[model samples]
Target: MTDKRIIKSSKVLVTGGAGFIGSNLVDRLLEQGNQVVCLDNFATGKRENLDLALQNKNFTLVEGDIRNYEDCVRAVKGCDYVLHQAALGSVPRSIKDPITSTDVNIGGFVKMLFAAKEEGVKRFVYAASSSTYGDSTNMPKVEDIIGNPLSPYAITKYANEVYAQNFTDTYGIETIGLRYFNVFGRRQDPNGAYAAVIPKFVMQLMAHESPIINGDGTFSRDFTYIENVIQANQLAAIVSYDNIKELQVGSKSVFNVAYGERTDLNQLFNILKKNLSEFDYKISDVNVIYGENRAGDIPHSLANIDKGKNILGYNPEYCIQRGLEEACKWYWENL
Candidate 1:
């Protein structure tokens, strides 16, 4: 991270600000003395995520949908930077309802990008996904290397990168995309059909119930912590345009935002159980159940974070073990 955090004392707009990641970013921005506006419709976001932010004088909540251009324009009003975190996430959800996912992830993305351009924001940083790696057999995924998108959710994220680059080329808007790998942390929702594995497993184990693995437990991911993601967003918001153009592949910059390490599902399960068992003795005795692999699931995932470190001065502070310790502690105390 840079000594001079560039986004300080500025007006910033965080789309999907009521969600887990968005709300955390909002709180960080507000704490740094930035006037922050959060845009969310509560479709997947929880209002309680903004409880602390709402109490802060620097925070404003815009109850609106990104699918609506007018709502997008209103949210971008007078903001210097736009962190576009809004999207319909989850592979199974997209597989079941590709149309709605397309409307929200693709259509909503275009509206937010155009709104930033129209508002003349200094920069636009967005939440990209590791799912863009798709069916690639690459050991450590790089920014330029990719394979066919396995799910509609992956396609939408790739489309976001494409549109962001095009906007930079055609409209002269500065954009940066952070391809996040399996981000987990505080405030992540634990109850839902589309809940992420970490939080879902935490809740089940809290109740002394068995947590099920989606496969034979060989699948792996480069589980990144949320604080590292926040660091990447700040760096992307601040890095000079000249520096970005030098690394530009298609008029914009994209980097893999990860901890640069992989953990298998079996290892993840054991860690979670061990961490949560501190709260309840029975949790230590709980066992895991294995089922068929999920649709659109990848066998392994890892990232090469050299691009971010070399260009943006990004040094991730938390590894998987440290991150899981923090996340598990939060779930036990708060949820």
Candidate 2:
């Protein structure tokens, strides 16, 4: 049996709590009997995501931006744990407007950290991205070995780790960074210019549009599910050890939050087509247009999740096919 003592009485704050992964974390936290506060600017977060939580008295919603110090301060006050998930994600979006991405991703993160430190939060856990693994050709990306960042977005996320470590060393804030690999699930927006692959494809297939494959469909990702991220956040929030002196606040001791598996684009497409074919057989096609390879995209990304499994007790319950099925159902019903 797992000990419930650590989180049972904690007051939690989830930044960007109205977004896909953040909202799901809010649900899990509230289910475990924690007093949860959600802070969001609604830049990318949808108001409908919080509909279920609004009925719960234990939940509070704060309209705010993390880039503003006062907003961060107000949100962090009296919170035991902070899950910072607010950021501008996507390489194309970042490439189009690097300034806004930097402001929200880097500037907002620093402000959140400073506020968390001042508020005396127990532990600060933020969403880190696998994009930090940039141009490195290694099959299974390890935490220690990283290559140069290829995009402005990658640079901002990498900078968050640097600032996180600096805050830990200079101040006394405890922090853990989970490098998420292509997280997708329910409540993920599929109607945006920067929509993620799974949701985007599901929507396209449902609408009878060809889901554009960026390259020759050989590109692949670990494609972690959102539930795994929720687990990581909860574990990181309550993780305690006797060695406080040896602990680094911004240590950037990162872990790959993935299932340690890889699925190529073509394979994933076939699986999606097979599953959706029950609804409409005409959707099955091997005719994805081969566009120019996107800039700043890595050829293949696989995570070595042993560290997460051993240290954080991370066990992902869904692989890509299963996850995509759930995602497709959600999109089909909602969109």
The number of clashing residue pairs in each candidate reads 0, 4
Which stretches of candidate 2 lie above 4 Å from their native place? 1-6, 241-252, 285-287
Alpha carbon deviation, residue 88, candidate 1 (Å):
0.5
Report residue 64 deviation for candidate 1 (angstroms). 0.5
lDDT per prediction? 0.93, 0.84
Candidate whose lDDT is highest: 1
Tell me the tens digit of each residue's lDDT in model 1 across 114-219.
9999999999999999999999998899899899999999999999999999999899999999999999999999999999999999999998889899888999
Stretches of model 1 off by over 4 angstroms after superposition? 1-6, 248-252
TM-score of each: 0.98, 0.94
User: Which digits, one per residue and each the tens of the lDDT, describe model 2 over residues 113-163?
Assistant: 999999999889988989998999877998877889989999999999988
lDDT of 2 at 6: 38
- The local lDDT score (0 to 100) that residue 8 gets in candidate 2 is 66
